[model samples]
Structure formats: C-alpha cells, structure tokens
Target: MPTLQIREAIREAMREEMVRDDKVFLMGEEVGHYQGAYKCSQGLLEQFGEKRVVDTPITETGFAGVGIGAAMCGLRPIIEFMTFNFSAVAFDQILNNAAKIHHMTGGQFSVPIVFRGPNAAAHMLGSTHSQAFDSFYAHIPGLKVVSVATPYDAKGLLKSAIRDPNPVIFFESELMYSVRGEVPEEEYLIPIGEADIKRPGDDVTLLCWGQSVPTALAAAELAQEHSDLSAEVIDLRTLRPLDTEAIIASVKKTNRVVIAEHGWPYGGVGAELVDRIQRLAFDWLDAPVARVCYDDIPFAYAENLEHLSIPQPEDVHAALRQVAYRD
Candidate 1:
C-alpha cells in the first residue's frame, strides 16, 4: 500500500475509471485548465484531453442538467460543484430530474451520474461556504449519498460510485483533501452502504461520517486516555442506505452511542440516525442515544462564532462522556 492524500486518491479514482470506460467523463467549473477547485483533478486535462476533462461556465444548474441528460443517454458523467453549498442552485435538477428519471421512465433509463465536490467547512471560508448539505441529499429517495473521510475510503468508495448504474452524490471535504492515508497500489473497491468500525471498544460507540470521523476518533482516544473509557468509532461512509446493521451491532456491544456530524442539529443526519437507533437498537442501549452536531443556526463569518456553530472533538468527547455516565 502507498500513502496518498485525499485529493490524490480522488484524482486517481476518476483517472482510472475514465481509462477503464470511455463513457466516463468529468465536467465542472475549474476542472480543466484550472486542474480542480481543490486540485483534486490535477493533470486530468492533459491526460484525458479537453473533451473528457471539461471546464464549464459558472452555472451549476446548467452543467448539472447537462450531466443528467448525458447520463440518460448512456454516458457516465461526473459533475463537480466547487462547493456543495452552491449545489443549491442545481438542487432542482438533482431532486426532480436526476433522482427521479429512472423510476419516472420505468427502468427505461438509469442516470449513471456522480455529483461530487468539496463539502462541509474548510477553515475560515466564511458562513456561506461552510455549511454542509449531507442530510438534504441523503433524504432523497433515488440517490446514493456517500461522504468520504479517509484517503483509502475516498478512493475505494469513489470507484464503486462511478461503476454503479444510478445517481450518486459523492461528498468530499475541502478540509480533508490534504489528509493522507494508506491506499493500495492495486485497484480496490469498498462497497457502498457499509459502515466501517475504525476502532473497536466496549464502553461506548461513536458513530460518525465525513469530517466527523476524525473528530470521533480523537474523542475516542481522549476517552480512553482520560476516563479509561473504551469507545468504538464507526464511520457511516454512506449516509443513505445507512449501515444500520453495523450500527446496531456496535450499540449492542457498547450499550451506549453518540452520533456526530457536521450538519445542523435540526433535522440533521444525526437525528435520523437517532430515530433508527431508538427504533431498532433501543432494547440493547444502556443510555439514551445522544448526538454531537452543529447548533441549529446558520454558520457565522466570525472565526470564534463559526467554531461555536460547528461540532468539534471536544463536543464529541463530552457526548461520549455523557453517554458513558463518566462526567
């Protein structure tokens, strides 16, 4: 295995899929001559030529619709939004057309399209650019939602997403693009809708995804060191079609759980997870399921206020402690 950055892992997945299938093409703002908004597609323009690695105008809705149409016509299109916050402009395309096309056409057409790009907050990029939409897209009926954290998962899950014959919302984090992890030199794929237990423990289960995976791991470490608490951290890599079995097994083992994510507390992804936990795993739980999510408010431009709005490792740690009755 070779260590690679999340950006490199993403670029490799696209490049490999493009070579394996000529129908697979990447088109988005800043993808061609600009390499990628986060340099995730560096060198793709020269390797695949301007046609496959295309640069579009600053029109998200226009490009998204074009991608959906292309997918319906037997092409595998990967549409990148500079930031997922801008995906709002193209939500109508994704929600009404891309997602519903297959069922609307009665299996006559399948949208083999991937909508991907940086998601969640990145440093002090301001309020408008910081909020995450993981919950919104995951709520859709006809979409497979994936939010990747590790370099390995970023590569493997992305390859799987590209090959799937349905609409996929692939989420990458601007804040996680530079994080490095071991990725195999040989190609591999991690099946979507599976949860990975990053670390095993007995006291509590820390369920999380995307940016919050690292936070959960950190909190698990802190709990072990400071409170002598053994905490399991499970990464719910795919939000939709969630790995409920994995979650239930962990909850049964630990008897306590704390869900974490970058989304707001109100109708957050964590809320749905809470519902599932109580409905399915309630008998095994020792304590009520708790969550660590951002405040139910828009992200603020000020650094300190933004920090307050976003969930952090300390927040997760406290949630774990609260669940474990260690506080």
Candidate 2:
C-alpha cells in the first residue's frame, strides 16, 4: 500500500486507464497544458502528448458535446469540468445525449464516458462555484453517480467509472483533493454502488458521502465523547445506484439515522435516502430520520456567512444526539 492524496489517486487511475486502453483520452479546460485545474493531471500531457491529454476552450457545452460524440464513435473519453458547478453548461449533452444514447439505440450504442472534476463548496468559492449537484446528476436514469471520500475509493471507483459502459459522473470535493490516505499499490477496482461502513456502531447511523463523510465521522467521535452514543458511519461511495440495502441494514441495526450532505436541505440526497429508509425500515426506527445539510439559501461569499451555510461537525453531533435520544 502507498499513501496518496485524492488528486494523486485520481491521476493514477486516469494514467493507468489511458495506458491500458489506447482509446481512453482526456479532454477538458486546462487539462492538458495546465495539467488540470487542481493539478490532478500533472505530467499527463508530457507523457501522453497533446493528442491524448487535450485542452479545450472554456466552453463546457462545446467540449462536452465533443466528448459525447467521441464516446459514441467508440473512444472512451474522460471529460473534466474543472468544477461540477460549471457542468451545468453541459447539461444538454450529459442529460440528453450521454444518458439517452444507449437506451435510445436499444443498447446498440453506448456512451462509455466519464465526466469528472471537483464538486461542492471549498472554503468561500461563493454561490456559483459552491453548489453540490450530486442529487441533480443522480436523479437521471442512465447516469452513474460516484462520490468518493478517500484516496483508496477515489482510485478504485474512478477506474471502474472509466471502464463503465455508460456515462458516469465522478464528483470529487476540492477540499478532499489534498487529503491523504492509504491506497493499494496493485491495480484494483471498487465496484460502483457499494457502500462502506467506515465505523460500525449500534446506537445510531450517520449516512454521508464525499466531504460530508469526514464531518459525519467527526460527529460520531464527538457523540461518543460527549453522550456515550455509538454512531455507525456509512460512506456512500456511490450515489446513484445508492446502496439502499446497506442503508436499510444500518438503520435497522442502529434504529436511528442522521443523513448529512453539503447541499441544500430541500430535495437533497439526504432527503431521498430518508424516504427510502422510512419506507423500508420504518418499524426499526425509534426516531424520525434527521438531516444535517446546507441551509436553504444561496451560498454566501462572506466567510462568516459561508461557515453558517453548510452543516458542521457540531451540527452533526447535535443531530446524532437527538436521534440517539441523548440530546
């Protein structure tokens, strides 16, 4: 095993995939010459050359459409958006073409593409750059949405996503790009849609993904320290093919759950998970599912206001205490 940051792990995945398959190439703003906006593609351009590691104009829609067309023509394209918030400009290509091509062609044509880049808020990037579109992308039928929290998961899931037959949305958190964790040196792939129990407990469940996973784990630690509550923490490695079974199982054992996300409260990923939990394991729940999420408002540019917008560990701690009847 080797320790690597999320960015390094992602770079390794792309590097390996591109070397393994000649058809696999990268195209996005600043990906080639700039070596990726976040340096995830460092040295890739020099190794793979200008042909494979391509840099496109700032137009997300234009490059995104080109990527889709390339994928349809049998090339595996990894389209980076710089940030997922910018991906909205490519919504037509992602939702209309990449998502529908396979089914529309009755499985004869497939969009073997991976759309990836930094996602969610990092520090005070402001409203335009801070939105989390995981829920939005996950809602689409043909897309596979993956949200990784660790270096290990980042590498494995990304490899799988690149090899997937359909379009996959790989959402990375800018805040987690520099976070270090142990990743296997040998090649590996973590199947999408599998959930990992980061911490096992009996009192309550904390369900989260991406940056929120760390927040939930911190909250779990605080819960144990302050209230002696054992909180089970589940990292949803994949969002779309949500591991509903894992969620139901955790809720059944803990008898309570608190869902946390860095997105808006209304119609967030937490809300959808709560609905499924209530429908599948209502009888096992001792309290209503609690959600720790962003306040329903446009993200503020001010530091203080930004801090208050997203849920914090303290908020998760409070939610955990309540769900555990320890508040």
Candidate 3:
C-alpha cells in the first residue's frame, strides 16, 4: 500500500482508465493548460496531449452537453465542473439529456460518462461557490451519485464509475483534496452503492459520507473519550443506490444513530436516511435519530461564519451524545 492525497488518487484513477480505454477522455475548464483547477489532472495534458485532455471556455453547459453527446456516440467522457454549484449552469443537460437518454431510447443508448468536481463549502468561498448537490443529483432517475471521502475509496469508486455504462455524478470535496490515506498499488474497484463501516461500536451509529465521514469519525472518538459512548461510523460511499441493508444492520446493532452531512437540513440526504432507518429498524432503536446538518441558510463568505455554517465535529459529538442518551 502507498499513501496518496485525494487529488493524486483521482488523477491516478483517470490516468489508469485513459490508458486502459482509448475512448476515455477528459474535458473541462483549465484542465489542459492549467493542469486542472485543483491539480487533479496534473501531468495528464502532457501525457495524453491536447486532444484527449481539453480545456474549454468557462461555459459549463457547453462542455457538459459536449460530454453527453460524445457519450451517446460511444465515448467515455469525464466532464469536470470547477465546482458543482457552477454545475447548475449545465443542469438541463445533465438531468434531461444524459440522465434520460438510456431510458428514453429503450436502452438503445448508454451515457458512459462521468461528471466530476469538488462539491460543498470550502473555506471562505461564498454561497454561490460552496453548495452541495448530493440530494438534488441523487433525485435523478438515471444518474449514479458517488461521494468519496478517503483516497482509497476515491480511486476505487472513480474507477468503478468510469467502467459503468451510465452517467455517473462523482462528487469530491474541495476541503479533502489534500487529505492523505493508504491506497493499494494494484488494480481495484469498489462496487458502487456499498456502505463501509469505518469503525464498529455498540452504543450508537454515526451515519455519514464524503467530507462528513472524517467529522463523524472524530465525533466517535470524542464520544468515547468524554463519556465512554461507543459510536459505530458508517460511510455511505454512494448516495443514490444507498446501501440500505448496511444502514439497517448498523442501526439494529447500535440501537441509536446520528446522521451528519455538509448540506442543508430541509429535504436533505439525512432526512431520507432517517425515514429509511425509522421504517426498517424502528423497533430496534432506543432513541430518535439525530442529525447534524447545516442551518438552513446560504453559505457565508467570512471564515468563522463559513465554519459555523456546515456540520462540524462538535455538532456530531453533541448529536451522538444526545442520541446515545449520554448527554
């Protein structure tokens, strides 16, 4: 095993896939000449050349539509939006054409494309640039949403997403690009829609994904230190085809749960999880499911205010304590 930053893992996944498949190509703003906005595609331009690694104008819709069209014509295109908030500019193409093409054509066509980029709030980046669309994109019928937390999961899941013959919405966190973790050198693929129990415990289950996975883990450790409350942490690696079995099993074992994410509370992803857990494991639960999510407001630009806006480790700890009846 080798340690790799999230960005490096992502680049390796794309690089390996491009080498494995001739039809695979990357197209986005600043990807070719600038080596990617966050360096996720660094060294790709020189290795693959300008044709495979393209730089488009700032227009998200144009490039997204281009990717969708290319996919329909039998190419695997990885389209990157600077941030998913900017992806709103290309929502119609993503939701309408790419998502519907396979079903609308009676399986005559498949959109083997990956729309990937950093998502959610980054330090001091205003409301427009720092929104998470996990819930929104997961609502689509044909798109598969993959939100990654660790370098290992990033490489494995991205590799899986690229091979699948469907439109995959790969959401990464801007705040996690530098986070390092162990990744194996040999080829691997983590199946889509699987939940990983990062830590097993008996008192409570801390359900989370993406950037919040680390937050939940920290909260679990803090809960153990402060009150001897053992918290099991489940990372829902993929959102749309959520691993309901893993969630129910964890909830049944722990008897309490706290959901956390960097998204708004109203109709958030946590809300859906709460609904499923209550319905499937209602009798097993000892307490109502607690959630740690953003206060339903636009993201703030100030550093302190921004920090206060999204879910934090403290929030998770508090929620875990309440749910575990250790408050």
Candidate 4:
C-alpha cells in the first residue's frame, strides 16, 4: 500500500485508463501545457502526447460540446472544468446534449465522457465559485454523478466512471487534493451506486459524501468521547441512482439519521436522502431525520464567514447529538 494525495490518485486513474484504451483522451483549458489549474494532470502531456492530452481555450461550452461530439463518434473523452462554477457556461451541452443523446437515440449512442474537476467551497473563493452543484446534476435523469472524499475512492470511482457507457460528472474538492490516504497498488474499480460505511455504529447514521464524509467521521469520533453512542457514517459515492438500500439498512439499524452536505440546505443531495429515508424507511425511524448543510447565505470572502458558510465538524457533532437524543 502507498499513501497518495487525492489529486495524484485521480491523475493515476486517468493516465492508466488512457493507456488501456486508445479511445480515451483528455481535453480542457490548461490541462496539457499548464498541467491543469490544480496540477492534477501534471506530466500527462508528455506521457500521452498533445493528441491525447489536449489544452482547449478558456471556453467551457465550446470544449464541452466538442467532447460530447467526440464521445458520439466512439471516443471516450474526459473534460475538465477549472472549477465546477465555470461549468454553468456549458450547462446546455452537459444537461441537454450529453445527458440525452443515448436516450434520444434509443441507446444507439453512448457518451462515455467524464466531466470532472474541483467543486464546492474552498477557503474564501466566494459566492460564485464556492457553490456545490452535485444535487443539480443528480436531479437529471440520464447523467451519473460521483463525488469522492478520499484517495482510494477517487482512483476507484474515476476508473469506473470512465468505463461506464454514459456521461458521468466526477466532483473533487479543491481543498482535498493535498489530503493523503492509503491506496493499493493493484488496479481496482468501485462500483457505481454503492454506499460505503466508513464507520459502523448502532445509535445513529450520518450520511455524507465528498468532503463532508470525513467531517461526519470526525464528528463520530468526537461523539464517542461524550457517550457510548456509535454513529454509522455512509459515504454516498454516487448521487444519481443513490444506493438507497444501504442508507435504508443503516437507518433501520440505528433508528435515527443525520444527513450532512457541504452545500446549501435547500435542494441539496442531503435533502433528497432525507426525503427517500422518510419514504422508504419511515417505520424504522425512531425520530425525525436530521440534516446538516451549509448556511443558505452566499459564501463570504472573509475567512471567518467562509468557515461559518460550510458545514463544520462542530455542526455535524451538534446535529448528531440532536438526532441521537431526540424524542
């Protein structure tokens, strides 16, 4: 086993996939010469050459449309957005074209493309760049969405997304790129639509994904210090086609759940999880399901205000206590 940063793991996944499949290629602004805005694609240009690792202009819409067209022609293209905030410029290409082509053609075309990059609030990046759009993509019927929190999941899930015969939106956190975790040397692929329980518990369930997964795990550690309350933490690796069975099963055992997300409280992935639990596992719950999310206000540039904007460990711990002790 080797400890690798989340960014390195993602780069390795892309490099290996490109080598394995001739149809696989990468294109985005600064992806080739600049080695990616975050350097996640460092050294890829030299290894894969310009044809495979391309640098497009700063036009997300144009490049995204190009990637969709390439996928239709039997190429697997990985498109990177400097940040997901910029992806809004290409929303029509992503939401309408890439997401609908296969269905519109009655499975005659498969868009095996991956649109990925840093997502969510990082430091004081402010209102425009700090938002999380995982729920928005998950709401779409044809697209598959994945947000990974650790190096292991980053490698495994990205590999899986690249191979799937559909468009996948892979989200990585800018702040998490440097975080290190153990990753096995052997090749592996974590299946889509599967939930992983990072920590097993009997008292409460903390459902989270991406950066919030680790935040919930930390809250579970702190909760152990206060009482014998064990918290089950579920890492929702995929948003669309959510592994509802895993979540429902966890809630059935714990009898209470607290869903956490790094996005706004309304119309977030956490809201959907809570809604599903009530619909599917209502009888199993002992108390009302609780949710932990970023404050509804736009993210502020000030560091202190930014800290309050996103979900923190203390917020998760408080939510856990509230759910655990609820009548």
lDDT values, one for every candidate: 0.93, 0.93, 0.93, 0.92
TM-score to true structure, per model = 0.99, 0.99, 0.99, 0.98
Model 4 residue runs over 4 Å out of place are none
lDDT of 2 by residue, 236-287 (tens): 9899899999999988889999998988888888888989998999899999
Residue-level lDDT tens digits of model 4 in 5-57: 99999999999999999899999999999899999999999998999999998
> How far off is model 4, as Cα RMSD?
1.1
- Residue 127 lDDT (model 2): 92
Q: Cα deviation of 252 in candidate 2 (Å)?
A: 1.0
- lDDT by residue (1-327, candidate 1, tens digit) is 789999999999999999999999999999999899899999999999988998999999999999999999999999999999999999999999999999999999999999999898888887788888999999999999999999999999999999999899999999899999999999899999999989999999899899999988989888888888899999999998899999989898889999988888888898998899899988898999998888887777888998888888888889889988887
Error of 4 at 226 (Å): 2.0
User: For residues 1-327, what per-residue lDDT tens digits would candidate 3 score against the true structure?
Assistant: 789999999999999999999899999999998999999999999999998999999889999999999999999999988899989999999999999999999999989999999998888888899898999998899999999999999999999999999999999999899999999999999999999999999999899999899999998898999879899999999998999999999888999999998898999999999999989999999999998998799988988898888788888999988987775
Residue 186 shift from truth in candidate 1, angstroms: 0.5
The RMSD of every model to the true structure, in order and in angstroms, is 0.8, 0.7, 0.8, 1.1
Which segments of model 3 are wrong by more than 4 Å?
none
